[model samples]
Target: MTATQLSARALLLDMDGTLVNSDAVVERCWRRWAAAQGLDGDHVMSVVHGRQGHLSMAILLPERPVEQNLAENRAMLAAETADTEGIVPVPGAPRFMAELAGLPHALVTSADTGLARVRMAAAGLPYPELAVTAEQVGASKPDPEGFLKAAAALGVDPADCLVFEDSQAGIQAGLAAGMRVVGVGPRAAAHRPTVQVADLTSVRVTRDADGGLLVAL
Candidate 1:
């Protein structure tokens, strides 16, 4: 696989779709929820990825009350975490992440700490030291709050951050946060990322003696 070289001071990654493949559980849960609400599952699926559960719910059922959306989001989170069937890391995710160990990076996701742990473990991936979960951000993806907060926690400039995202909302958030975005899959292409890669498998990064990384795209 060929990749263009790039430089960045920090990496900000999305958890579920980008690093881990929890599609089976995610879609199943959402599909059930859509059925319960009489909403179109296809539309719900289109809007749900990369956005917080509550945000997805609100988008899919705009006429519903906010409190109801919150309550349902909580239930969905619990249900999704309770089942790990078919949950696994995305292709090349572990290897790419292993290479990024000891580097300045953050796991920025719509899932909170507990769900993040369950999914990451199910996928056999490492937990990031610096993470910005849904609980920490006031707003969800397409808002840029998560990515901005993660970059701040790492003490890195937002412009110096490279974000790996698999959702349109996540890509928008990264771009709005003033970071370079790498689209991680086919879905991400619609967001028009700085670069698009099939998966994390081909990603390579090397540390220079000067303490900077030369990312091999």
Candidate 2:
């Protein structure tokens, strides 16, 4: 659908891969973790996309108990924080965010609160007025918990919001929450979002004559 087709009251956005270029850092951290566990980094990265660290740990090292996975994930997060040199905002993300500033919007991410802060700060991204971090939601992407929580926090019905995402799992979560989805990035095209664009550069949010927010792509 075109941006004119969407009449959104709020916007829900994802962090990694969407507003931020954390993919390399994520893959490197996960690969490091996988190596320590004698697993393949490629395999781990694929399974962990848009998933919480705990979930990724569990999947990568299923033989270990949940507690251990949690600990390892924390350690990995620390490593990632120390290596934040490469982290930066996605193309056009800063401008897109500026466009949405002061508007109703929330960031929903699979990263735990601490990790989320570290990443967002590193990328010089503004913190959303509202957010659903890994600690706040029971389920991660591919599940609607985060997106739904964002909608609730924004005081908007799911149907009245639009979700911006990059991963297949994230797009699925937005759709599951009954919100329109705008996908960004290369893999975004595979998810069949309401709209697909290479980056936030292709997207624009404007006030419609009807006094509603219109999202265009």
Q: lDDT per prediction? A: 0.91, 0.84
Best by lDDT: 1
lDDT against true structure, model 1: 0.91
User: Per model, how many backbone clashes are there?
Assistant: 0, 2
Every model's TM-score: 0.97, 0.93
lDDT tens digits, residue span 1-217, model 1: 5679878899999998899999999899999998988888898899999888998888777898999999999999999989899998999998988998999999999998999999999999999888899889899999999999988899999998999999999999999999999999788888899999998888898886778777886
Native-structure RMSD, model 1 = 1.1
Best by TM-score: 1
Estimate the Cα RMSD of every predicted model relative to the unseen true structure.
1.1, 1.9
TM-score for candidate 2, residues paired by index:
0.93
